[model samples]
Target: MRPGGSRLECCATDLRPRPPPPPSSSPQDPAIPSGPSLPPAPALRDLAGRLRRLPPSCGPVRLIGVDGHAGSGKSTFAGRLARALGGAPVLHLDDIASHEELFGWTGRLLAQVVEPLGRGETAHYRPYDWRTRRFGPPRALPPAPVILVEGVGAGRRALRPWLAALLWLELPAEQAWARGRDRDGEEQRAFWDGWVPAERRHFRDDPSRPHADLLVRPGHSVHEGYDVLPGPAGTAGQGPDSHRT
Candidate 1:
């Protein structure tokens, strides 16, 4: 609500390590640990290949939605994944959101970005400037083979049907919010105070996890890569409803 109403035009990695087998109880067999073992993470190349092969979700573009709580490393992870996909274009939701309409920019996105891309045309949007609290000149996003939409509510119900695959960062809200608050620091403390409740309310009413195709867990180190697991919504190959347009 900075200037435009609800219709405002605004706006991966892989590592695998095998643990040594547990000591054998008898000479015949090794005793497995009672604790569950996580499946090996897919290589980054492998994940990229899989994503590239998905059916186009928006016209000629495979619109990949990378959704998660703020400061959950969605941007960092999406950057890596975009590199893996050979420099896919990324559209940050931050560019679409204004201070006044934190989670209310859905309609603007659909009209300015999604609709044009859906019709195999270039999408132009004016990115929001948080500091100035105003929108800048229009920017263009061509329909690429793969385009990543990364932000907090990328997987909201309204946008899910158009996603080739929805990815959720598997980080708890408290920890994620803490990281966000710290990153924003004391200067933006008041903003964070308002943001936390708004984010909570948004998720409570329209949770994205239940509709995510994959849950991405970051590794401990930069080179360690990420662990990707199937989410409650569906697996990679199982397409969501495509007829919805």
Candidate 2:
């Protein structure tokens, strides 16, 4: 059945909800070393390689989820990873989320994407356009060898069964929100004020990372001040032979 609903509004922890990547690390991000020491570069490369080899967690296709706080870099990482995987398909949560629905798009996702993917059929969804605050045209997602679901609750309870790997982008709430606010700027401050707390409550009720198989934090610092650090914590919490980050 097709799902239909509207998202709820929220009051902020701070109505004044004022909100990177680097070599080594930065205050916004913490360096979490894996149990066994491996060179940073090789470790990440191995992760990508292993993901490629893992038997499809969902049917014959690997349904990897890159979940984390908003502005935690899920979208950016998912895009690059898709490129690495030779143009893999990525289903962005932003498409499902609307100005009113926000995180309430799960039902729409299940009805539109997950169920179809389970049948190895194409999934269709009308992505929500934020600027105009309306859903765009229906997008068809083919059953590829791998499909990425990246967003805040990509690993939520409702979608777990369909996932081959659940990856959490390890960025704290404060730091993550700060970046989000900075990126969106003061113009959207009102929207963000409501968003931060709503996000907090959403994570509180339906947490994703605790059960994640791996946690990715990728970036590095250059001679220029822009720090780019790409580090991931490998921890596939469950699955008999699943790996840990």
Candidate 3:
């Protein structure tokens, strides 16, 4: 087990015009092929607007937390949400985590990213080079209207108080791990062996789902986007205990 609360601080297009567009069909239409959902454009736009309007949880930034299992599509989902938020900045936890300290980079993150942002200043953090086992050059993260922190443990207890909203990708653990393993392939097989158990322990003690403001589920296809629903926390930006089990 690793230490917790280590200190510190905190779109696309298409083109091709071959045939006329199909008749408008309600999303509920069963006959509709689950292929072009595209992150529920209208919903995402509304969410973006809401997030922008929210009071900044950090100094001048609405720090949104996107938490989920290792391979539950947090990165992809955050990328789409960022575009919907008009190019909002996103901080991937992967850049902060390393082989030896997989879930123990909180101190580095707080000092490098959160503290500066909390002070209404630019934050610079060195991204970890997994291949080299060392941190890289610093990258700056300005205080934006909305900034997404995406990865596992993003909504952990220590960071929840600083989040404007916490979103959890709803997916079964076994399935998510399987996808992660497959994505990493044989080269990272040993890594996965160590990671799976660590992740399980992390979630077991500091679960994020019960405190999520929204629950996101990927659609049937890559193009199908995602389906966002009220999470166990009920209304977005509300109290964490509002719907905790």
| Candidate 2 RMSD computed on C-alpha atoms after optimal superposition onto the true structure | 11.7
**TM-score of every prediction relative to native:** 0.79, 0.73, 0.79
Error of 1 at 150 (Å): 0.2
Weakest 10 consecutive residues of candidate 3 by summed lDDT: 8-17
Query: Each model's C-alpha lDDT?
Result: 0.69, 0.61, 0.69
- Which regions of candidate 1 deviate over 4 angstroms? 1-42, 236-245
lDDT of 2 by residue, 1-245 (tens): 00121111110000001113222111112222222232223333454565676666555677888788876767666655565566778887877877677789889998998888888888899977666767788899989887889777899888877776677766678878887677656666787788888888898999887766555543332111111222132322223332222
CA lDDT of 3 in candidate 3? 23
- Output the number of the TM-score-best candidate: 3
Instruction: Give me candidate 3's TM-score against the actual structure.
Output: 0.79
Q: Which stretches of candidate 3 lie over 4 Å from their true place?
A: 1-40, 236-245
| Per-prediction tally of clashes | 0, 20, 2
For model 1, where is the 10-residue window of minimal lDDT? 2-11
The sequence of per-residue lDDT tens digits that candidate 1 reaches over residues 29-115 is: 011122224222245655677777777888888888989888677776676667667778989787898878889999999999999
Model 2: worst 10 consecutive residues (lDDT sum): 10-19
Question: lDDT score of model 1?
Answer: 0.69
